[model samples]
Structures are given as C-alpha cells and as structure tokens.
Target: MIRDILYTLDSPYRAPLEITGFRFGKGEKTVAIVGAIRGNEVQQLYICSQLISKLRALEAKGAITSDNEILVVPSACPYSMNIGKRFWAVDNTDINRMFPGYDRGETTQRIADGLFQHVRGYSYGIQFASFYMPGDFIPHVRMMETGFQSTSLANLFGLPYVLVRHPRPYDTTTLNYNWQMNQTNAFSVYTNQTDRIDEVSAKQAVDAVLRFLSRIGVVRYHCHNGFLASVIDEDQLYSITAPDGGIYRGICHPGDEVTRGDLLGEILDPYTGDVRAPVVSPTEGIVFFGYAQPLVMEHAILYRIIRRLHG
Candidate 1:
C-alpha cells in the first residue's frame, strides 16, 4: 500500500489542506474510489476508509492483480469536516459542484481541478456519495444518463438497485458527470446514512466494491454475489411530499414495502403536538428513501417509492 498527497492548497490561516490517496498494486489505472466531498458525509468517508483497509489487506496478501491499480481517496474536504460545515468553510461553495474545474476559478474550483487531475483517466470511478438532503436511502448504485453509462457494468457491484438519473443542467459540473464525459465509467454508490455510520450498510458497500473489483479482475478476492440489481430510472420513483411544515414522525423507513393509501408518516404541530397532516403512500411500492429530519417544511419530499407493477 502506498499513501500520497494527491492535491494540496496552502491555507493562509490554517495548515495546508491536502487531499490524500491510497494506492494498491502497480500497473494500469483500473479503479478509483472517492469519498466525502462534503463535510457531513461521515458514512461516505467511513466506507472509503473501510475500503482502504480492505485493499491494504488484499495488497499485503498479493491479492491485487499485478497489472491493475486501485486508488482510494477517503476524504476530499477535510477542512469543512473539521469545522462541521457541509461545504467549503470560507465561501460556503460546494466542491462537488465545481468538477472538471478551472484552475484559476475559485477555491473550490481549484480543489476540484487538482483532485480531478489525479482521479480522471481510470477505467472505472466509484464515488461513495451522499444525497443533498438529510435522509436515509436504500443502498443503490446510481449513474448519470450520459451516453456513456452502462447499467451492465454497474450491476457488477451487486447492489440492490441501479438507478439511472437524467442529469439536469447543474449536474454537468458534478464529478460523476464529468468523469463520464471524460470516457470513464463512473458510478455513485449510495448507502443508508450520510452523517452517521451504519456498520451493516458500510460492510455491504465494501463487499460490493470488492465484488466489482474481483469480477473485473482488478483484484483477487472472494465475496458473495451481491444482488441482481433492479435497474430503475429516476423518473419511475414516486415522491411523497409533506403537506404542512411541522415535526415529522415517520412510520416507515427505506426498504420498507407499503401499499397504496398506507399511512407512511405524519406531521405534527411543533408546539401543540396535534397531527398537522398524515403522509400516505400514493402507490403500492418499496420505499427507496425516507426523510430523516425531525422537522420539515411544507412540500418537502418525505419519501421516494419504487412503484410496484401488478397485473
């Protein structure tokens, strides 16, 4: 195992910020795994760390293929993580939204550029990604609907779901999208939690990565065939929204099955504790995501369900 600083920026008020990467094996740039572009993505960071640990063991045992290389970057924005902020501490800009960045643009852009220079050109790119909202998700592998996307390759990870999302204008700046544009097969792996570590899901994620590497011949390791991933388009998900702003009380979570009209959750008045609204499932399906925050605003998305098809 080899550790090196992939990128660095000298900070005026603090120690120099560095993005570190861990490398295993020695030849082709086969796979690159990234974690925690945002500060609050503790789960993402944890998963990357676990991947690094596992890769180290594999490398020590000569399990990694000699002609393939794997790079694991555990954290991209440690400064924000240190201060408990989600975005860049100085300007509140998201480093994730500045991908394939210009070197002369801004702080976040420069960081993105520096990191991208090192991460791009790999055969595959995997990002331990978190949602923009605070919530829990059913573990899945997500890919942008860029012309380069390959669901067949994504399925090798063996996660429960493979979601193909249509990219919006803002998505063009994201790392995944940019990597795809650069001809790299990019995938974003989403686990259950973002701010807190979920050991079960973390292990699942690590196993998934190992499975993919082994299947692709990047490493030699034995792991169970994960899941025959259910390929779903992002548009197929049913979004359940909050009717009123208040305290959220959820009766179901991600991966739960629900029927139409089922009372999935309720919103209560923050002060009086009276039920403000009852959030119900509009279709019979599986819960793909559930809002985790105690408080919510009107029209906030409470759940995303994968609508089940019936005869």
Candidate 2:
C-alpha cells in the first residue's frame, strides 16, 4: 500500500527524494494525513504507519467503506529523520515554520513547496505533530480561521481539546497555512515534547482521528463515549512562574488536576539552606502543562493552569 512519489527538485542531486503515502478507498473527498515535518516527531510518523496498515487491510478485504480518500505521508522530513535532528540537512531551518514555500529557495522551502503541491487537491488536510521541543502537552488540534473544513474536522477528530487559532504571524510558511491558501481543508494536531516518542500523545491523536473519520462518515465505527479531554480557551490558560531559584516542582504532572492555592512546587536556595518560595496553583482546574528540567530560574514557568471560565 506504499505509493512513492518523487517530486522533482532543482538540484544536482538527481533522484528525487521518495515521499511515501498509503492510499485507501475511493471517493471525491481526499484526506492527506502527514507527519514528521520536524524530524524529531517520529511518533507521529509511527502513528500514521499504524493507521495506514489498518486502512490498507480494510481496503484489500473490501471492508474499507469510506468513499473518501485517505493518503498517509508517514514522514515529511526525511533528512531530519535520518540525522535525528529537527531541521533540514542543507540548512538547519524549521520546516513547520516555513509555509507556502519558495521554489528558488533552500531544502526546507523546496520540501514545503513540494508538499503543498501534492496535497493541494485534497478536501481535508491533517498535519500530525508533537513538540519539536520536549515537554508534555495537553493533546489538542489547532484550526485556522480560513479552514472551515479544518474546524469541522477538528470537531470530528473529537480530541479532548479542539482549539481554533489563527496561524501565528510566523506560521505563514507552514504546511497548514499553505493548504489554507490553496483552498484545501487543513488543520494541525499536536502534543507537547519533542525528540522523544510519547505513546500517550500518539494514542490520543489516533483516537481523535478515528472519531473524526467516523463523524465525517468517511468510515464506520463505534467510538467509545467520554473520549474527549476538556478543551479550554487560551485566554483561560495562565502560567505560574518560579519567583525564586532551585529545582522546584511539586507532586504534579502535566495532566493532573489541582485546586486553587494548592502547593504546585517550590524554589529552593540550597546554597543558603533556604526554601525560597513555594509556587501555588492560581485556579481550581487541570494542570495543563509544566516545565520538565530541574535547573530553575526566576520567571521560569513552573506550570500552566487552565481555569474554568464561568459562563
């Protein structure tokens, strides 16, 4: 089920890089699911591979019922994947940050341009990603204002949190924005932490996607109830900073729940044998995320709190 497409690039390097996709079912609606724009996010690529294997089996047996198209790009950044780095080999640049792409530019731009061209015809575009930087994430999907289809897909994906965010000013060169400009339905699903495979985030992503496929009628399946995590608005998210110094963190993980005034962590001055100050939770809600490294500094974010907004 692996179909390799070589996009011709203007380079002395003759053979085009092999981009692989798993094609399944037959329909007017095509969904291009891509992963590993950042080489470090091998987990996303792995998830895509799993999805393709299942879908391909269904296709072979005639059990695949979706009239819609599902094209899976398991790894977009091959160079990065090879080097175990996050950027392209020619010049170390972030592929995700570079959107529409330039034909006359470097490797990152060329790849973006190539990717944009290949996915332009799709009805829905999904980009799977994890933090190219390592950290725990509250699983979420980000949809662009221009992506009506993406918004719908985000809901269908049924992730715990579906957030509609404008592509940051710096995100113009990303695949998501390029899909938007081409009138292709596009959205991005992401988890926190980079360079390491997080099984929890991967499963959460797959779960959301399966729910989405079912909701769109692209596939038939029974989704377990209570599948989504609590989706919160960005405005409701607040970060608690370390006021003092020392390795400070309380008994809290990324997804733990906390009440207001709960002791989240503390900064200590071991040299002076002093416990500088304790960082406390500001609201009663879930601990959406926190820093992982131990060496602390003043103004370092210890935790991000998502307060329940009163309606």
Clashes in each model (backbone N, CA, C under 3 Å)? 0, 10
lDDT of 1: 0.94
lDDT of 2 by residue, 238-274 (tens): 8888787786656687778889888887776767646
lDDT of 2 at 70: 77
Highest TM-score, which number? Answer: 1
lDDT of 2 at 132: 32
Runs of candidate 1 exceeding 4 Å displacement: none
Residue 38 in model 1: lDDT: 96
Error of 2 at 247 (Å): 3.2
Q: Against the hidden reference, what TM-scores do the models get?
A: 0.99, 0.85
List, residue by residue over 182-210, the lDDT tens digit for candidate 1: 99999999999888999999999999999
Candidate 1 versus truth, CA RMSD in Å, comes to 0.8
Q: In model 2, which residue pairs have backbone atoms overlapping below 3 Å?
A: 98-173, 98-174, 99-173, 99-174, 133-194, 134-193, 134-194, 135-193, 156-212, 160-229
